[model samples]
Target: MPLWNVYHPVGAYTAQQKQEFAADVTAFYAHRGLPKFYVVTIFHEIPESSFLIGGTPSGTAVRIMIDHIAHHAPDPAARQQIDDSLTRLLAPHTRDRGLYCEFHIDETPRDLWMINGLRPPASGSEAEHLWVRENQPVPY
Candidate 1:
């Protein structure tokens, strides 16, 4: 599974935008072969004064931290692709506002990550499908 945490300065995005943002992130993974249910997105709005860039308080900052199993992106090229995609998806919210947007990915070895008291299966594998079907008892 992949989890995305979007941390943005308060007032930078409207409620609708936040919803759209999450949807876009989810879609990104789905397009990359991940099942929709396996993607989780969380939004955190922080006070503008609480964030800094170059040691100066920032009013327009959006940071997305994504965690996933190792080899998900696989290589630098793939990682850049993801970064570029995120930059494009976030441009509307950051570019015009002179905001800073960053997408950081953290990959952990699958053997070391566990969910529902069990280790997850390989990405997009049949076992993963079974895992999703078994553990995802409720629809998102």
Candidate 2:
């Protein structure tokens, strides 16, 4: 699962933009064979007073924290590909909007993750494909 946490100044994005961004993020993973339900994007709107940069309030910065559990880049090339894709995905939402953005990814051990009390199936396994089709957890 790729859990994306987006932190931005309040009013930086409209409801429609948030929905669109979430869909875009989900599609990025779905294209790579992850179940649609496995991609979760959460938006955190911070008040200007509460969001600080270098000990000063900053209204133009956005931060993203991504936790990858079901999959991880297997090598440096794969990691670069992921990073490039993410950069492209974020351009319109951040750079195009004149927002300074910072993001980092943390890969957690797959064995340490679960959904509906069940471990996700191996990548590309029949069970995993079924979950992708069903868009939910099922006993494998």
Best candidate, lDDT: 2
Worst 10 residues of 2 by lDDT: 111-120
Q: Which window of 10 residues has the lowest lDDT sum in candidate 1?
A: 131-140
Number of the predicted model whose TM-score against the real structure is largest:
2
- The sequence of per-residue lDDT tens digits that candidate 2 reaches over residues 50-122 is 9999999999999999999988999999999999999999999998999999999999999999898998999
Please give the distance, in angstroms, between residue 23's alpha carbon in candidate 2 and its true position after superposition: 0.6
TM-score of decoy 2: 0.97
CA lDDT of 8 in candidate 1? Answer: 85
Instruction: Give me the overall lDDT of model 1.
Output: 0.74
TM-score of 1: 0.80
